[model samples]
Each structure stands twice: as C-alpha cells, then as structure tokens.
Target chain A: MKARVFVTLKNGVLDPQGKAIANALHGLGFAGVGDVRQGKVIDIELAERDEARARATLKEMCEKLLANTVIEKYEIELQA
Target chain B: MKSAVIVFPASNCDRDAATALKQLTGQTPHMVWHRDSELPQVDLVVLPGGFSYGDYLRCGAMASQSAIMRAIKAHADRGGAVLGICNGFQVLTEAHLLPGALMRNANLQFVCRPVALEVNETQSAFTRKYEHGQRVVFPVAHGDGNYFADDETLNRLEGEGRVALRYAPGQNPNGSARDIAGILNQKRNVLGLMPHPERVVDPLLGGTDGIKLFQGLLETLS
Candidate 1:
C-alpha cells in the first residue's frame, strides 16, 4: 500500500511561506486569487494494504514527525 | 564544575558554546552527541543553536525527538541546569520542555542581527549576574523566533517571573510578545532564549555583553 500525508499550518496560525508565495503570484500578474495557503504532501510506501492500519500509522507519524502539532495539522490517505 | 554541550548533527554553534563554557569556567565541557542515550554527569547542559535535522518538519521539531533529548529530559527532571539558545530554544519548545512555540517573524523573513535585550527577571540561576531591567546586546539569526503561547500561559509566565529577558525598547526584531527574548521553566533551572549570547562573548567580537551570561552559569555551578 501507499499513503499520502498532507500537512498544513492550522487556520488561525500564520503561514509566512504561504503569504510570501501569494505575494509572488500577485506580482506575476495573476488576478482574482482570493487566497493562497501552502502545504506539503509526503508519500510513503508500506508493506501492508490495510487502509485502517495505514491511517493509524500515518497519524502517529504526523504526531511524531510529519507535522508539528503546535502550529500545523495533518490528514492521511491510503491507496491500494 | 562539570558541563556538557549537546551536539546535534547540524548544530553549527556547538564549538562556540563549548568555547564560551571553557573560557568562562576553565573546565572543558563534554560534547555529547545527539545519538547518545546518556549525558555526561554535569551541573550544566547546553543546547546550542543551528539547523538541527536540517530544520525539517519545522525548526527544532525533528531534533526534539532524537535519542539524546530523552536523556536531556531525564537530566532536567533531576534538576540539572539546561540552557538552550536559538535553535536549541525551538527544540526545547518542541520537546514540550517549555510552554509556547516559535513562529516565523511577523515580517515573514529571516532576521540576523544584533538586538538589545533587557533582563526581565534576575532571580533565575541564568540571570543572577544581571540586575532586573539591565540591557544587553546579542545576535539573533533565525526565521522563527516569535514565541507564542496561550493567554493563560503568558499570564502565568509573567506572574511567576519566568520571563527572564525581553527585547528592549524599539528592538522588536522578531515581533515577539512584549518583545520577549528569553524565558525560564517554572522551576527556573531550564532556560530557553533565542539570542546568540555565545556570539557576543568576546570583546573583540564587537561586544562583551554575553560574557556575563556565561559567567553567571559558571558562578552558579561553582
């Protein structure tokens, strides 16, 4: 099985990198871009195809490494 | 007095911290690797600044979970004095050794420069050399040094006199609350500060304000 983890700064937390990217996009003549937030997607390969177990493991990974709970949150998806 | 400096793989300031300790105490500190399970029996332990674990997952986030931090936690639990500077401070927060977390500067840029800090609390072991409200200069180089905590935590910190240093008037380099530059644990044995005091130790390095901080540690352990 393969899993993907998406980690992003919580809504209320400041996302400096996202803001910088938004500014850069606006400078490049992009129009009507209401908002922009940046996040990371981490892909991992697992030996088992159990989606439930993979999700649990990914949550643990997020708490331990994939995300910083202090400022960011994470979601996981597993694919067969 | 025995002292040790924890060295994570990417810790660029380890040597500077060790030198400051050696010069101040005339006792060379043991350089403990992050992989080690135990720290040397010492009165003081320093977590120096730099991009630990390449600042991945978040500044100091990954480094906080390294093997040595467990030992460091144990040492701190035993009331050993621990001082964390810059990235070290970030790690301490990520390790849950201190309240609050550091976020990117309000300007969304990496700030590297000398900033003035006023001693906010002089009762802690780390600030005994300076009187309350005394000013000192130290260099800060980091993208995330704006400390954040809940209102209750902030109030508790202020009420307990755990705020050890504050950026002086008009020197809000990182936009930290109350221009906070450093804080101590509730017990006052652990200190986490964003300024690079080690960089300001030598008089020829354009400042000597930081020498007093290291000297204060030496005095405490002796």
Candidate 2:
C-alpha cells in the first residue's frame, strides 16, 4: 500500500512563501492568480497490507511527526 | 552557577552559549548531547540556536522530539530555569513548553541584524537585572522568528505580564505579534526568544547588554 499526505498551514495562518510565489508569478506576467497557499506533500510506501491499518498509521505519523497540529493540517490518502 | 547547554545535531550556538555562561558563572557549562536521556545537576539549561535536524518538517520540530527533551521538561516542571534562543525558541513551541509558533519571516527572507528590544517586564528571573522599559540591543539571526499565537493566548500573555521583551517601537524585524521578542512561561522559569543574547554578552563583541540576562538568573538562584 502507498499513502500520500499533504501538510498545509491552517487557515488564517500567514503564508509568506506562498505570497512571494504569487508576486513572482505576477512579475512574470501571469495575472489573475488568486491567493496562493503553500503546502508540502509526503509520499509514503508502506508495507502494511491492510487498508485500514495503513490509514491508521498515516494518521499516527501526521499527529506524531509529519504535521504540527498547532499550525498545520494534514490529509491522508491511501492507495492499494 | 552550574549550567548545561543542550547540543542537538547542527546546533551551532551551543559553544557561544557555553562561553557566555562560563563567563558569568566561572564554570564551563556542561555540553549535553540531544540523545542523552539524563541531564547533569545544573542551575540553568539552555537550548541554543542552530538548524537542528536541518530544520526539517518545521524548525525545531524534530529536535523537540529528541530523547533529551523529556529530561528538560522534567527540569522545567520542577521550576528550574530554562532558556531557548532562536531555533531553541521554535523547539520550545513545538514541544508545547511555550505558547505560539514561529512562522517564516513576513518578508520571506532570513533576517540577521542587530535589533533593539524593550524590556517589557523585569519581574521574571530572566529579566530582573534590567529595568522595565529599558532598551537593549541584541542580534537576531533566523529565517523563522515571526511569533504567532491565537488572540486569546496573546491577551492572556499580555494580561499576565508573561511577555518579557518586545522589539522597540517601529523596530519589529520579524512581524512577531505585538512585537514580542521574548516570553516567559506561566512559572516564569522558562524563556524563549529569537535574539541571540549569548552572542552579545561580551563588551568586545560590541555590547554587553546581554550579560545581565545570565547574571540575573545567577542572582535569582543564589
């Protein structure tokens, strides 16, 4: 099984990197871009055969290490 | 006074912290590695600045989970003095020892410069040597030093006088909330700040305003 996790700053949190990226895009003549928020994706290859077990492990990973619940939110997707 | 400087992988400021403490106390601080589960008997524990664990995941996130933090927490629970500088501040937040998180600089650049700070409250062990509202200069060097906390927490901190220091008016270098440069925990035994006071303790280093911080701790403990 494989799992993908997306970690992003919580809503209302400032995203300076995203704002800089948006400014650079506009400077390159790419207009009409709305607010851009930056996030990170972590791809995990798991040996766990059970779908439920994989998801549970991913959640644990996010809570314990991958994401800081105080400022980040994480979503997990499991693929078999 | 006995002191210990926790050294995480890539902790570049441990030496400076050790030097500053030695200068103040006449004893070299114990250089404790992050993986050590035990701490030496000491009066102060310092988490120095550096790109710990390469600042992966988030600044200080991985470092906060190291084996040594448990001991540090135990020390803090006993009302022992603990100070976190720069990356150490981030670790304290990640470890939930302090309120709020340090976000990237508002300008998205690593800011390194001498910044003027105001002593917000001198009642704590960390700032007792300085008069309230006095201005001091310390060099801040970091990419993620902008402190953020929920409104309620900010209000509580302000009301309780837990805010130990603030950037001088119009001198906020990292957009920290209310221009906070340093804060104390509820017990006032733990302090976290972005500026490198350890780097500014010697007069030959351009200023010795930071010396009082460590000296104040020794005075309080004695």
Candidate 3:
C-alpha cells in the first residue's frame, strides 16, 4: 500500500510562509488569491497489504512525526 | 553545578554552552551526542542552538526523536534541570517537554539582534538570580522565534507563573505571542527560550547579562 499525507497549519494558527506566498502571488497580479495557506504533502510506500493496517500505521506516523498537532493538522490517504 | 550539553548534528552552540558552563559553574560539561542513549549523571542538561538535522520537515522535529531524547525526557521527568535555547527550544517543544510551538517570524524574515527581555518569573531555577521584572539584553538569532499557544494554555502558563521571560516593551523582535521569550515547564524544571544567553555570558563577549541565569541554576541545582 502507498500512503499520502497532507499537513497544514491549523486555521487559527499564524502562518508567515503562507502569508508570504499570498503576497508574492498578489505581487504577480494574481489578485484573486485570498487567504492563501500552504501545506506539505508526503508520500510513503508500505509493504502492508491490509488497507486498515496501512491506514492505522500512517495515522501513527502522522501523529508521531508528520504533524505537530499544536499548530498543524494532518490528513492521511491510503492506496492499496 | 555539574552539567551536560547535548550535541545534535549541526548544533553550533554546544561549544559556547560548554564554555559558559565552564566559566559559570567551574566544571566541564559532558558533550553527549544525539545517538547516545545514556545520559551521564548531572544536575542540568543544556540543549544549545543551531540548525539541527538541517531543520528538515520542521525545525527540531527530526532531532526531537533522537535516541538521547528518551534519557533527556527521563531527566526532566525526574525534575532535573533542562535548558533548551534557540533551536534547542524548538526541540523541547517538538518533544512535548514544553508546550507551544515556534512559528516563522511574522515578518517572514530572520531576526538577529540583542533583544531586551524582562524576567517575568524569577521563581524557577533558570531565572531566580534575576530580579522579577528586571530587564536584560540577550542576543537572539533565528528565523522561527515567534511563539504561539492556545488561549487556554496561555492563561494557564500565566496563572501558574510558568512564563519566565518576556520581550521588553517595543522589543519584540520576532513577534512572539504575548512577547514571551522564555517559558518553564509545569514543574518549572525545564526551560525553553529562543534567545542566546550563552552568547552574552562574558564581559569580553559584548556583555554578561546571562551570567545570572547560569548562576541561578548553579545555586539551585548544586
């Protein structure tokens, strides 16, 4: 199974990098960009054939190291 | 007081911390590597600054899972003194030994300067030497020093007197929430701060405002 993780800053948390990206987009004349927030995507390959087990493992990984949970949230996707 | 300084990969302040320990405590600090699982017997453990693990994924995130962290956590659990400065502070937060997270500066720029900080709570071993509300200049050099915490956590820290240092008025270099510069854990044995007190420990090193911080730990832990 292959797992994909998306991590992003929580809604109420301050994200300076995301703000910079928004500003840069505006400077480039992309005026429609509003409240732009940035996030990271991580792909992992797992040998576990069971979808349930892979998802559980991915969730553990996300909780342990992929996401801080203090200012960020994470979503995991599994593909068998 | 006898102490040890954890040396993580890319840690640039370990030597400075050792020098400060030698000068302040008159004892050499054990330089323990991140891979080492056993922590020597010491009253205090110092985590110095610098980009650890190349700041991969997140600052201090990779290093927080280091093998030595278990021992360090054990030390903190025992109510031993643990001081994390700069990148070290990031590691402490990542390790969950301290609350809150340090985000990128609000200006999205690296801030490096001698920032004025007021000692808010001098009851902890890390700040007892300084007078409450005293102002001190400590050099801060980092890109992610903006501190953040939920309102509940913020209020609890304030109520418990766990906030040890705050930026002096108009001196918030990184826009940290509530101008918090340093904080102590619930037990007040672990302290994490973004400033580099080790850099200003000697008179010849531009200033000695950080001497009292080391002295306080020496007096309390020794």
Candidate 4:
C-alpha cells in the first residue's frame, strides 16, 4: 500500500512563500490572482495491508515528520 | 551558577552561546550532545540556533525528538531554566515546551539585521535586569521567525504577561503577531526568542544590549 500526505499552512497563519509566488505571478503579467497558498505533497510506501493501521501510522508520521503541528496541518490519502 | 548548552548535529551557535555563558557566569558551559539522555546539574540550559538535522523535515521538528530533548523536558519539569534562540525557539515550539509557532518571514526573505525590541514585560528571571518598555537592540537572523498562535492563546499570554519582548516602534522585521519577539513559559523560567542575543554580548562586536538578559539570569541564580 501507498499513501500521500498533503501538508499546508493552517488557515490564518501567514504564508510567505505563497505570498512571494503571488507577487511573481503578478509581475509576470497575470492579473486577478486573488491569493496563493503553498503546500507539500509526500508519498509514502507502506508494508501494512490494513487501511486502519495505515491511517494510524500515517497520522504518527504526519505529527512526527510530515507536518509541523504548530504551523501546518496535514491530510493523508491512502491508495491501493 | 552552572549552565549547559545543548549542541545538535548542525548547531553553529553552540560555541557562541557557550562563550557568552562562560563570559557572563565565569564558568564554562557543558556542551551536551543531542544524544545525551541526561543533562548536567546546572542552573540553566540553552538550546543554541542552527539548522538541526539540516532541518530535514521541518525546522526543529526532528531535533525535538532527539534523545537530549527528553532530558531537557525533564529538566524543565523540575523547574530548571531554559532558553531557546532562533532555531532553538522553533524546537521549543515543536516540542510543546512553549506556545505558538515560528513561521517564515512575511517578506519571504532570510532576515539578518539588528532589530530594536521593546521590553514588553520583564517580570521573569530572564528579563529582570531590564525595565519595562525600554528598547534594546539585538541581531535577528532567521527565515522562519514569525510567531503565530490562536487568539485565545494570545490573549491568555498577554493577560499573564508572558510576552517578554516585542519589536520596537516601526521595526517588525518578521511580521510577528503583536510584534512579539520573545515569550516566557507559564512558570516564567523558560524563554524562547527569535533574536540572537548571544551574538551581541560585546560592544566591540556590535552591541551590548543582550548582555543584560544573560546578566539578569545570573542575578536570578544568586
């Protein structure tokens, strides 16, 4: 089994990288780009067969490594 | 007073911190490695700034799980004083030793400059040498130094007077909420700040505004 984790800065937290990207887009002549927020996508290959077990382990991974709970939130997608 | 400086794999400021401690306290600080399960008997423990574990997962995320952190937490539980600077502040937040998180600078640039900070409230042992509302200049050098927290937590911190320092008038280099530059734990023994006070201990190098912070802690040890 494989899993993908998407980590993003929590809402209301400032996103400097996203803001810089938005600025770059505006400088490139792209108009009306309201706002941009950046995120990280991490793919993991697991040895577990049970989805429940995978979700639990992935949650630990997110809390421990994939995401900074202080500033970011994470969502996991399990795939077969 | 005895003190120790925790040295992670990639910590570059451990020496500076150790030097400051030795100069201020007249005793060499124990340079404890990250893997140590125990810290020496000391009055203060400092987590110096640097890219721990090369910031592998996120700033301070990996270092928070290292063997030494468990000891640091235990030490804190026993009421020992702890100070975290720059990357150390990130580790303190990641380890849940302090409230709020340090995010990237609002300008999306690595900020390295001498920022003037107002001594918001100096009731703690960390800032007892300074007067409230006084301005001090120290160097801040970090990418993710913007502090953020929920409104309730922020309110509680303000009410408790745990906010130790704020960017001085017209000088919020990182866009931190409420212009916060440093905070203290509920017990007021632990302090985490984004500025590098150890870097400005001597006037010949640049400034001496940071000397009072270390001196204040020394006074508390007596």
Q: Pick by lDDT: which candidate is best?
A: 3
Positional deviation of residue A33's Cα in model 1 after best superposition, in angstroms: 1.6
Better of 1 and 3 by DockQ: 3
Each model's DockQ score: 0.61, 0.80, 0.90, 0.77
Sort by TM-score, top down from the best: 3, 2, 4, 1
In order, candidate lDDTs are 0.89, 0.93, 0.94, 0.91
TM-score of model 1's chain A: 0.92
| TM-score of the B chain in each candidate versus the native B chain | 0.98, 0.99, 0.99, 0.98
* Top-TM-score structure, candidate number: 3
Better of 1 and 2 by TM-score: 2
Which ten-residue region of model 2 chain A has the weakest summed lDDT?
A63-72
Stretches of candidate 4 off by over 4 Å are A30-32
Tens digits of per-residue lDDT, candidate 3, B1-222, equal: 889999999999999999999999999999999999999999999999999999999999999999999999999999899999999999999999999999988998898889999999999898988999999999999999999999999999999999999999999988899999999999999999999999999889899999999999999988
- Over 4 Å off in model 2, which ranges? none
Model 1, clash count? 0
Better of 1 and 4 by TM-score: 4
Q: Model 4: clashing residue pairs?
A: none
Task: Give candidate 3's whole-model lDDT.
Answer: 0.94
lDDT of 3 at B101: 94
Better of 2 and 3 by TM-score: 3
**What does candidate 4's lDDT look like per residue over A4-73, in tens digits?**
9999999877787898899899999999998899999999999999999999999999887788876789
Candidates arranged by lDDT, highest first: 3, 2, 4, 1
TM values, all candidates: 0.95, 0.97, 0.98, 0.96
Docking category of candidate 2? medium
Report per-candidate TM-score of chain A alone.
0.92, 0.96, 0.94, 0.93
